[model samples]
Target chain A: MIAKVARYILFSLWTVALATFAQAADFSGKAAVDTRFFTEPPIFAQQKDGVAYPSVMIQPEFRHDWGSGNNRLTVIPFARYDSLDKHRTHWDVREFSWLHMQKNWDLLVGVGKVFWGTTESRQLVDIINQSDLIEKFSGEEKLGQPMMNLNLPTDYGHFSLFYLPYFRERTFPSSNGRFLFDPPVRNSEGKLDGFSHWQPSFAGRWSKTFGDWDVGVAHFWGVGREPRLVPSFGQGFTHPPTGLVPIYDLIHQTSIDVQGVLGNWIWKAEAITRSGQGDRFAAAVVGFEYTKYGVFGGSKDVGFLLEYLYDGRSSFAPPTPFNNDIFSGIRVVFNDPQNTEFLFTNTVDLNTHATILGFNASRRLGEKWKIELESRFFANISATKNPFAPPKEILTGMRNDDYIQLRVVRHF
Target chain B: MKLKSLICGVLLMAAFPALAQTDEEKGYAIQAEANRRDNGYIDSMHDAVMTLKNAQGEVSTREFVVKTLEVADDGDKEMGIFHSPADVKGTAVLTFSHGTKPDDQWIYLPSLKRVKRVATVNKSGPFVGSEFAFEDISSWELDKYRYRYLRDEEIDGNDCFVVENYPVYEYSGYTKQIEWLDKKMYQPRKIEFYDRKGALLKTLTFSDYNQYLDRYWRAGKLQMDNVQNGKSTELLRKNYRFKNNFSDRDFTENALKNVR
Candidate 1:
């Protein structure tokens, strides 16, 4: 009850502060209503019924600038309420930072977000923030990380230094959610309390462009965002393996990303080497996207994408489904006033023959509204019951969780 | 006697400049003069409201801010930040134009907080659902086309030089373009684009000319009409500010991400 009161007070204070800033700053936001449909019934009895899940989300962004546009403050707060799954309802501060721009350098402080990679199949080199798995499984959504960032551009390249002061634990579905893991992660409220901590980490990157090529090299000594699942037995839990507790470890990673364009083809590659989680391992993703403009003698463009993913690590390391996979996708853009687009992708595991298919289509409703359709299907998923066979694919738990979702967003 | 004859020949050449010039040479000279007259603004910025109308007469609009920095001995660097079509707000695109080779482009998607390299070979694709193609709006360089002088023409009571420009760049949507250059401003008053099949595809007209910094000529409104599709687009520009002190750093990917 005391914690609830503190949260209420903080919410009120934040609202009051934003109201005050509205008079002099720029304010914008988006509110989205989402509905998802599962193709099959729930695999676990503890999970919610398999059918339609409705949710509503809102994100408000406020930016204030002073001192001749050299000093700036941006705040973005997001919240979602799901009708079916309580754990899926959450809140996050996407970004709240102050940026001070100078002639040769820039400084950013407070909670911020940064992205660093070029591959379309996977972001092997992007490791700044924890993934918001509850929001999406594609790892595109991230929780803001508290950081002190300094960017310097010199004659050689663009250099950026980061001092991350705090770490955010990755969000995961609760036991009653559709995408729950085998042992059900301990992510429910009050179950995973006191899991995140304030640990200082350091990172740096240097990026530059030469002719048609863009290259970036970076090094990070920090807490790894991916956590190890530790079996834990707690009160009111089943025996054998009651729940899995996440354990974040410190790691040292060095990565390089390069992208170049030739004629109609855009090539991208990202490679990373890391240690501290287990034996030192290296991973890489290389791909290219070829675009054909004015296809069918019309104002439509189609692009074909192909990428290969490879990861080398011992069995003791954190499990990943993309150990040896090939990703292929197609993107279509209809050059109409509505700005309609469609994307279809498939990731196939070379060893296990497990494939995941994804499709997304989106179009604008007008100047202020937009609609999107998204679906994901898992095929050829094998069960882990047979220990004699090769270890079951990591995505076995989600074999029955194929879903199609629709979202309508209104921007203000 | 030899010096006298040489002096007479030089004077004759100056008096009748067309006599010594071929069609290509004359066209090149005219374009070079126009380029020279429009140099040294250093940088510029403006807000643009784009209205796209389909064949059925339905219309949609978008708003953005365009910033450009002049690069000596190369094509200009440009950055555009979208403000309207609210879903696309805070999205920015940075382009570095080059000569002979394809331009380098990158787009910053605010929702993803990621910057992705855009393929520049799609120069024929429409820009944001507008009638204007990517090649039409890119920074214009002299070497991108081969010039041929056509007969003089009068447009809206203004004396204009009609010149034919054959695109030297590959994958251009147009076979050739006929540009009517205003003799006084050295700026294009009108342009007619021919499709790859050697048929007229679109016509573009520029109006409301405004001079900035006592040197640069900027058009306040531009209209493009596609003859075959029966669609049109209008680009209305406002708040033409020049010499914004924008440097190379302001046109980089880092700068694009910071464009709120």
Candidate 2:
């Protein structure tokens, strides 16, 4: 079914491009490389088997800016590859889409992937969408990550709508196998069943400024999947399945954000709530940021934030063990864009008492080239045994992890 | 006191136009000579300063470099801007060649800088926050405006011919302008501008006409006052070089970034 849909979308796009070839412009290319390291290796002891691995991702993108009289059409085609240790390599076409803009209206339609995250926090709801096979079952767990996708926008506001279909692979087993009672299930028969298609999702965000205040509201619905949760274990089970049961059939997520600047002080606050899933999860975040000119020889902007997240359900999940979580962090940014180093962030998890520190620096080499460097450290301070163990035993008791990344970019 | 009385009596006698046959012919000859000189000298100016002022009494100044390409033996020609402000300063040249459509042009900003090209049709729009637009600044030959001899007048102590000029451009911003041309130098001493609705808009005053090259008369200072806005622009010329060796190659897109 998914293959048929993908083929139809490709054929339609080709037909449109051929009809407009005489008016189309040339093509361009953009590429980037990103590498991330996990401080605490995956804990394998609790899960019986798991692997703690380092990862590297690379993406190459090509786009065409087509001319159509008073209208403009843009098509971006991209491919990505991720190397997780020596045993696993994940690759796929992440984004493919056509965007048309004319006068005051814009229309976008495609079938590859999508992204739906609008906040700085990684825990609450990142909800990036990709095929289960490409992410190594990471999309089912609700782990926030980048993806190629279809998006549409109009002149009404800075808001966009997106739709992403789901795909399945045979390698990663589903986490919901324990719920099924085995009746001498055979491996070949299980492969013939394939994977079930999850429901599509709808999300909308609207933001506007009133006087000195900037206000925004975001809402999301429908049941897709979240990749952050591990499969539950039972007293008796057979073959591991390839997907998990949807956590919430109808999840309604909403958030309200307000930001204002008073003289030299800047204040921002956001309150978010998720309901209609037979479970209620709420998070409130507020922070005050102050920027002073000519401070300590050079100008510096320092900000501190206090955030609290509460989960009425799933308090014992290995990743989130506390019902109430408190986080605080401070960041200092340099005022100058050229010949300046900026950004220092430190965060602490109050319930588990874990801490994460990060620093980033950037400099311009000349008119076209720029260089950037980033480093981060994560430390676990829990006294309890490793409840959250990865799939392999080699990742058990992961304590401290450090990562450093450097990048250089040139503009045309 | 006696010398002042004698001079006043002679001015009064000169002002009275006696119905004599010789005086009428003399007046007609003077008008013809003035018209001939004004037509030739108005086409030769290569650069000038235009100043504009607004309602709040704020002043703005702009310098224009006009290049003329002679097309006929009589010197009727096409003229355009060699330089301007904004990112369009370099290879962005505006030309007004002889055409049914006032003038045509092509501007090239540095492509390497991601700046795009703009055509000449946009010239009818306003010029960078000033009341004068691109069309107003472009060279329009004397014949482009329908002229009528109003009367003899005195401007800045010089005998002048006041002429009302109606623009022949299909879509000009102004309807008419009244000009006072000095009889001796053929330089415009003052000009009153009217909007498309026939409402008085601005008045430009010229002063300090100095001879640059024996026969050429140039205004050292020019001011444009917006009657509606009460603002004006004052222009002062300095270090103007004429007949300098300049060519079309200097205005090409490839040489934009390399120049200045």
TM-score to true structure, per model: 0.94, 0.45
lDDT of 1 by residue, A44-120 (tens): 78888759999999999989998999999999999999987776799999999999999899999999999999998
Residue pairs of candidate 1 with colliding backbone atoms: none
Model 1 DockQ class: medium
Task: List chain A TM-scores, every candidate, in order.
Answer: 0.92, 0.63
Name the runs in model 2 displaced over 4 angstroms: A1-63, A66-88, A92-94, A102-104, A111-119, A122-195, A224-250, A276-278, A296-313, A316-340, A367-370, A383-398, A408-412, B1-260
Candidate 2 has an lDDT of 0.46
RMSD of each: 3.6, 19.0
Candidate 2 chain A, run of 10 with poorest lDDT: A176-185
lDDT of 2 at A229: 29
